[model samples]
Target: MSGEFDFTGQTAIVTGASKGLGRAYALWLATRGCAVVVSNRPAGDGSSSAQAVVEEIVAKGGRAVAHDGPVQTAEAAAAMVEIAATHFGAPDIFISNAGIQAFRPFSTVTLEEMRELLDINLWGCIVGLKAVWPAMVDKGYGRIVLTGSSAGLWGQKQSADYAASKGAMVGLARSVAIDVPKGTDIRVNVIAPAAYTPLSMGSIDPKWADYASPDHVAPVVGWLSSPLCQSSGGIYHAGAGNVRRAQILEGPVHRLAEGDIDTVMHALDRQPEWTSSFASGAEIMPEMVKASGS
Candidate 1:
């Protein structure tokens, strides 16, 4: 029933928090009265980069801890959740934001490259979800935000692997929303952010820098991770301080008859008008579960 992002006494875990969007998310949560776990793989400087973020949060009178490890591994993800519970409490929010991107032509992409992308971008999310879902279920409440990308929704040249990995996240969010048991309070959503982060800021034109700042995307994420967000299985586009839901719609279903080429052509011509958008998994699954009595 709460429609505000007030997270007092709650805990949050944000991966890839050494910099960029993850850092913004961690800081935002901390400012809103939540204890935070900031995680990132160590840098070549042999320093725990996540610690620096934690330190900054602590300096601002917020509670935070750091975990430095490769988030693509399930063991590492589990360890993060354990640390969160040990230090603070069972996390109320889980942001699966750790990912990697490699741009190479589809024809020239190596198996190694694809494997790496899938492992870090897609599998990392699965690991995070698996690690924290049971805890959320036990508490009967949770907010899970999986990161997606524009490339994933619409194909991008030289980014086949990246697109595939991100696209899988969208599907994962939708399926999880549908499959979770009835009466569960868990909310799962995906954000396809067009932000200027270390991952791609260098390639962005200077003129658009202000509009694409990572800060602009953090609020949308915060909203989704709060009790304010009622919608699940949704894909949102957030950038330049604007937010909107991205829906997957289909043309009206038309019955097909066994027929020759002429009949097929006529059916095509008579296809229902594409006026209304399709319902999301959140909108479609409740009735299904009710019918099945599961």
Candidate 2:
């Protein structure tokens, strides 16, 4: 069993905190003594969902503030960070969970529709990272979690736009984690979660909500956001009380021979079941040399 973790002096910014997974993450961190900035878009009624989350946290004697705005724009992301700084301190934890989805055939997915999804899912994370990265860099300590999806990990039918937005996040998180400065405790990771949020539960049976609830996935995200976690560029899948680590691997290069191109084509086309994954980009040349049999 792991020892207890604490976030007594930490501050967090959680996007889409008005409901679903984002709300759960805000509450999870706030209850652990982490001051939280609950960010989300305003409701159709013009009331902020974040306000209610902030009130709930305050009722429990936890510190929280509400920032109501779309996370897609740099201005809105900056506002969230500014609110965090004003209310608690520099945000050390950021969960870019604000996203939207619409299931449709890939052929039917128009450019305008894809643009909207990318603006929120992909560009939202980009702006959020840009907003708080400077503070984390200067402090040399931070935890960043990007919300990804299994659609990106594998693939899903009739989810072209959603998958595209999420796949971009997985790539973005990996790149950011790899580029973090040396000697800094700052880490960035992605989580591909399968939670039954409003998007799923509203259309399905209510009983299954207990089995795939957003609450079930919140703790996994908390662990990723904890200072105790040493992982960067880690990809995780969490939901329904099951947590897993995901990896991207590669097979050795198949050099083609000119002497008997057709004879060797079949061998080159065959994929190895067991192949090593890259430790870093720098390993490519060495691996290539080794594969060359030189």
Candidate 3:
């Protein structure tokens, strides 16, 4: 379906929009005519990244307002959400992209460090959802995008804590998608993106930078943020002009199989056929889904 995905007369709230993936998402939404609330951490050096983004949008005749503060704190997240309502109206779209990453071995990771990542990466998104959900519910329309990571999808050697944080997106998105009233027209999805932003620069080779530009991933997000997307609790991986889905596929029930420890271990070693996944968050029995050709 190649229908136009225009955003005229709409409003969006994008966290971490001062740069990176958030910046790309903000600019793309504005280009398509959506007013945006640009939220970012307050720069300590008397400079304003959020203001700079607002200026860029205004220079292009786009409507945007800068809100400074970290979303890691509920107070700051609420303030950031307030600007969207005050400036444009109840937020029609929300992209939770504000987060940080740390590189440490599981053996060396401390409780405080893990807690910090959780507070910012996972809890921060929860707060943003809590803040905007009521108004969106009242309006009876909303599109929510939560950021995930490859580290979370497939565990990383040096990013155990980060993986734990981002992995939470799956449960969160599905739960929210199922909880929304059946006819509300509200949908929540998760995008575990791989882009050449500050988040990945530390580890990726510089040569692959151009291939991994945020521009390549922005279109997928735009689609997720647009009316074209009809599915909820959808999980996707986007980068370098490539898009693929990530689903929780279940294997056949071995409840009837007879097995001792060794036999059971052998059965578990068999690769699960990619024949089925969950039908919805509320589903008690899993159903088979048509596997993608990709």
Task: Give the best candidate by TM-score.
Answer: 3
Across 1-294, the per-residue lDDT of candidate 2 in tens digits comes to 124768889999999888889989999888889999999989999888789999999999899999999889999999988999998999999999999878778888899988998899899989999999999999999999998877775666677777778888778987888889998999899987767787655433565566667888899999999977898888887776777787776666666654477766666544332121212211222333254343
lDDT of 1 by residue, 161-269 (tens): 8888888888899999887767878899999877668897555555555656788889999999998888799998777676778777655444556577677656654
Q: Give model 3's TM-score versus the native structure.
A: 0.89
Model 1 TM: 0.86
Which residue ranges in model 2 land beyond 4 Å of their true spot?
Answer: 1-3, 202-204, 258-294
Clash totals for all candidate models: 0, 0, 0
> RMSDs, each prediction?
9.3, 9.3, 7.3
Show the colliding residue pairs in model 2: none
lDDT of 3: 0.82
Better of 2 and 3 by TM-score: 3
Task: Choose the strongest candidate by lDDT.
Answer: 1
Q: What TM-score would every model get versus the actual structure?
A: 0.86, 0.87, 0.89
Please identify model 1 stretches exceeding 4 Å from their true place.
Answer: 1-3, 258-294
Residue-by-residue lDDT tens digits, candidate 3, 243-278: 878777655656435677677666754454322111
Query: Which candidate, 1 or 2, would have the higher TM-score against the true structure?
Result: 2
